[model samples]
Target: MDIKAYIESGIIESYVLGLATPQEADELQRLSQTYPEIAAAVAGGEQWLRETADHYALPAPEELKTQLLARLEHEFQPEKQAPDLRYYRRDLFKYAAAVLLLLLTVSGLLNVYLYNNYRNASRDFVRLQSGIDMMAADNKAFQAKLAVLEQDLRFITAPGTIKVPLAGVSGREDYFATLYWNTQTKNVYLTANHLPAPAPGKQYQLWAIVDGKPVSAGLLNPNCTDLCMVTPVQQAQAFAITLEKTGGNPTPTSDQMVVLGKVKA
Candidate 1:
């Protein structure tokens, strides 16, 4: 029932080339009637075979026509008293020309069918290959994303990690964020749990307060929604995030502060 698999199996090619067994041929005929794809595949195969045959077709021998005419004249030679055989000979030639014309007409029709089939098959192959390539690219991307998530999971579950919950400041009560810091390794990671996306040409920057002074940590990547590693700090009394231009400023813009959190003693 898998039409694509069946087409790729080369059974259609075998059937078109007159190489299929009786049972196989019967099955192909039945399937062709039942499925449009199967029918089209069969037509493509037939076209390919015909084109191949034409490409290798041998030219008729030059002496062949002379031999045929001589043999015909001898076979129809008139008796000694009878009139010359010219009239009968003319009729025979006419009949021969008619037969030759019929054969040429049939050959031309076959050529046309084969050419059309070849074009259709080529188009189908291009489309199928494109689809396969796209699927492969998507699969690779998914695997890469899964690997990153797995790494984040391991880091989150490690011991000696402190989780700082950041709450939205002022009117932005709905926004929130989280920061995970590993005290032993001096590593920090941030996640924008419920923060709204920054406006165009702006980004969110993290600041670590040390000895009552704000220290620039790093800028948060706008595209990252999950845990992302940030600048490490050995000590901090508080953490805050503020909106700034694309590249963050040396000092935090206090009015643009979105979320603020303090580290527990």
Candidate 2:
């Protein structure tokens, strides 16, 4: 149990002021017996209430005191009618003052308790809202990735999209890749199928042969696992991929060529 929080919750004040519900009063009584801090708090509250009552007790007026004495003297001399209430008026006023002070103190403590509860609730709401926002952002990113995959699937399966298989060369026979060319739209896409991962500070670059000379077909992303977009080519007799430095070079290195395939006539 949070002893400090419980002590500051105003339960003890309510219990002392006779305003706590039966269940709350019972719980406080049980806790007070089990916890020394709670017992001390309850005892302190009772002592403070006693002191406040004594502080608010007003001295009876001299004239009222004399009058009460005179009335008491006549009570034994003749037939005393009904008992006069003026005799107990002073005690009644003291009791009322004590009760009023206790009530005001209880109200202040109750306000403090309510404010604490409000602050805690606001903090919980903020944490919950933050979690919801993070989840929404993650879900949005997943949706965007799914949309890209769907678009790639459609592009590969569409009509007029030619699939070209580029086989390994220069003793690297195990290396292979595929190229997709949309002849009608002139769009090109490539997949590094069965190709080994590039080394540090190195990437792959694509080339298209045009009129017996090589033309830049853009660089391949090192992390790409699916269809990666490549620069379009108007006319190409063959397509080739070569290992190059990061960001690639303007010209393909003939000795570093990994895969090549001639376009079908």
Candidate 3:
């Protein structure tokens, strides 16, 4: 319905005069609840009527106020009321317990969360520190290796250093050796990895085999895993390894020709 047409009608004036039909009162209640504008208009009209009645106030006498209060007390006086001290105390205890339980649950959750996070953080920190220490150790090891390589290069390149080539032995498929000889200082670096280890109680005697005769230059033991031996060859031509008795034999054992290498001319 168009509220403008309803407002212009004389039903609101008739309702104020207490002459509206029951159907009109119900419709007005519904309109008041449905539309704030209609509610506001009705409230303003009622307020105006109240203000007009106030301006023409025939005030209530003091006797009327006392009589109205007496009538209210007579209408609502209770027949029986219990003293509820214990019951009220029990209710208060229940509410307090509920509040304490809630607080404890919240506190326990927070503590568990904090403990787990603290433990995880501690583990992470330890792992990071360990990684840092391992990196430092690896860096130091690499630096030491670099120093050893530099020293080796310098020692090999020194002046008057003899580089003697020891050729491969015939009939042994992969037998070869080289001697980095430093003749000026009588120091030789034997690269003897291709040679085989001699039998027990029999060592490899390094011989300077010149003109079909074996000269005992020096004896090279078979412990070449960590280091190479440094023995000078005073009169070297062809190299030969012979199996000799314990310590070493003065002459080469003819039957045990384990390795032989001719000197490169």
lDDT of 2 by residue, 45-113 (tens): 999889988999998887997888888985665455344455478679899999999999999999999
lDDT of 1 by residue, 60-173 (tens): 999998899988975775456334466678889999999999999999999999999999999999999999999999999999999998888778888878899999999989
Q: Pick the candidate with the highest TM-score.
A: 1
The TM-score ranking, best first, is 1, 2, 3
Worst 10 residues of 1 by lDDT: 77-86
Clashing pairs in 2: none
57-157, model 3: which lDDT tens digit per residue? Answer: 99789799888888897577455545466678889999999999999999999999999999999999999999999999999999997886676566578
Give each model's clash number: 0, 0, 0
Ranking according to lDDT, highest score first = 1, 2, 3
TM-score of 1: 0.60
Using lDDT as the measure, which candidate wins? 1
On TM-score, the stronger of 1 and 2 is 1
